[model samples]
Target: MISVLFAVLTAISNGSASVLQRRAASTVPDAEAMHLSLIRHLLRKKVWLAGIGLVVVAAVCQAVALATGPIAVVQPIFVIELPATLLIASCAFRVRLSRSAWRGVASVTCGLALGMAAAAPGGGSESVPGYRWIPALIVTGVFEAALIIWSRRLRGNARAALLGLAAACGYALTAALMKDAVSRLDNGGGVLALVSAWQLYGMAVAGVGALFLLQNALQAGSLVASQPMLTLGDALISITYGVTLFGESLRSGWWLLPELIGVALIAAGCVELARSPLMTGAKPPPPRVR
Candidate 1:
């Protein structure tokens, strides 16, 4: 339960960061997209800096979540990020959520509960084998490279989706590495062992890389295109890493039915939520005197 609580906190923090980053990123010129100059532009924006601060908070929460529980249980809970983003954006824009938006929130909430109950993710190791990390790093690097290349050929929403997915992969890999590194703290090594671990450094590199990719994704298109990809991609990819790297287990056979259904509901909810006027940057209705 501690894992779930921390994971939820992480999601909220990440959600808030995404909204703030998106605000800053949207102002960058199109010519700057995907270039290092894009980051330079964002660096001057206080909103982006605030987002980065929240990212640090999320990272601390995530480290605790991964350390306390199975990665399978911890990561999937991040699917709430999109819904959280919606709520935060609505609040910031001084707009009321539509009925459909509320429905979307309900669907996502129910779906996550159903899927987690059906899948019952559990029994993962604290540490992943060193040998496993080599292939994971190689494959992840190749995959992200391909996505970046493909994204460069597109514009608007398509580019955002691809880049968001790539960022998701980076985040998932970071989480896995963080788990491996953080586990040392409890494994008799304490702080000295954690600091000495190569995984700790790898996590930092991956986290920074992911942050860069996310900024580009935000700049490239609306949240409608990027948020769902970022949210769902992170959850699914993280689950894969959990199972493959840390040997996490989930229910199977008949349980797959509810799990699949839950995924469908979550996806549908995400689509609906992403299309909300508030998320799409439509002008909020003006206040009227009563």
Candidate 2:
């Protein structure tokens, strides 16, 4: 129960941090956008500093949650972060959430609950063998490298979306590795053991890569495109890793019907939220009557 609560806290902190960082990142100079020097400037901004603080808080919460809960249970809960970001942005930016936006929030909420419940994901043990890690890590690297190369040739929202997706993959892998490492720590591996573990090193690199991609995504275009891709992409990929790496499972044999339905609702909701005025900072589309 505490793990669930910690996961919720992680979601809240993560959602709020995204909004804050986006708001702060917008003020950054265009020339410095993709450069390493940008982080220096961002660190000087109070808002960015605050956002980083929240991110630290979020990471702590997530680590605790992963230690105690199934990766399947902990990670999908992050999908709600999209709607949470919208809500936080609406209040902080003083933007209005239109009727459609509220509807979208409700859709995401119900969908998340239904999907997670219907999925009924089961857990795995701490001892993931070395053989499983080889293919998984290789595939992850190749896919991310491909995404980076492809996105580099594009511009605007498309590039942002692709980069966000890549970042999502990185985060998913980081979460999985974190779970494994934490499990190791729980099962008698001390801090010294963790320092020597390859998963710990892998998680660090992946975490940095994810943050790098996220910053670039924010700079490239609107959160409208990037947010959903980041949210849904991470959730889905995390679910896959849970089953593959961590030996987690989901409900099947006809129970998949509701799972599919829930996925549909989540897609619809994220799309609606993306197109909303609150997220895009544009006027709401005109209501057409038959």
Candidate 3:
């Protein structure tokens, strides 16, 4: 399907972007964590700019995927971004990954396939009702605010995880708003309606906010700490938005078992990958042979 294909493209672009952005963000001072100075610092780094370019490409692909497919289906495919990031990092840094890293990647791949197949998400309204958006926005705003506030008190990986999850929620909100805005064009409202839609502007704001939060997440700690939260959190939160806000359906009853197993596999895979030196840009131990 076009949506799935585009979603995969989106994941690749995003994965590459994340690695570049992290490299740039790591140079900034820890005191600059969530400050505007962080953005200013990153703006000077060519690597960050390159990452931004990839982000734009991912955004275009994401827009196409969301327009052509259900948010539940499109967003979950991003689970591959972590593995892609690790692999890209491996290539970029010329670090060899251990066998366990490959196993983690395979586990994530199989888990996503199983989870998506089991959930089989389908049947959602393209346009959510305005009233429904009211509560959704309020709840999301509160949740993100709490996360940011809580993150300020933590350090290292903990801070990165919190900010990453917050950014994930923001990205999910952006996708939801993007889908709603684009529905104007789908419904034959043409360019005028699309431009005038509030969702369009909201999506822009949410996207920028999400980008800012993601920068802080990268600056907070190693990719090992931030990537899993960003990857898994986005998928889970987007699925919630799809189900609650867009009325998307997922299989239930017997399907719950596979879904749980898939989630476990994904979580375990993330943990394994998180332990890799590649994630932290640290040199791996020497390979021993018989």
How far off is residue 207 in model 2, in Å?
0.4
lDDT by residue (1-290, candidate 1, tens digit) is 89989999999999888878888999999999878999999999998899899999999999999999999999999989778878887787678887789999998999999999999999978998799888888999999999999999999999999999999999999999999999999999999999999999999999989999999999999887888888888998999999988999989999999999999999889878878766655676665669
- Candidate 3's error at 133, in angstroms? 0.5
Per-candidate clashes, comma-separated: 0, 0, 0
lDDT for 146 in candidate 1 is 100
- Model 2 spans with C-alpha error above 4 angstroms: 29-33, 88-96, 275-290
Tell me the lDDT of candidate 1.
Answer: 0.90
TM-scores for the candidates: 0.94, 0.89, 0.94
Better of 1 and 2 by TM-score: 1
The reply for model 1, stretches above 4 Å from the true place, is 88-94, 280-282, 286-290
Which residue pairs show collisions in model 1? none
Candidate maximizing lDDT: 3
CA lDDT of 124 in candidate 1?
76
Which lDDT tens digits does candidate 2 get at residues 1-290? 87788988888888777766776666667677568877887778897788788888988999999889888889889878768878887787666677888898999999999999899987677557878999999999999999989988887889889988998999999999998887778878689878888988889999988988888887777777788888888888999998988888899989899988888888788878877665554554555557
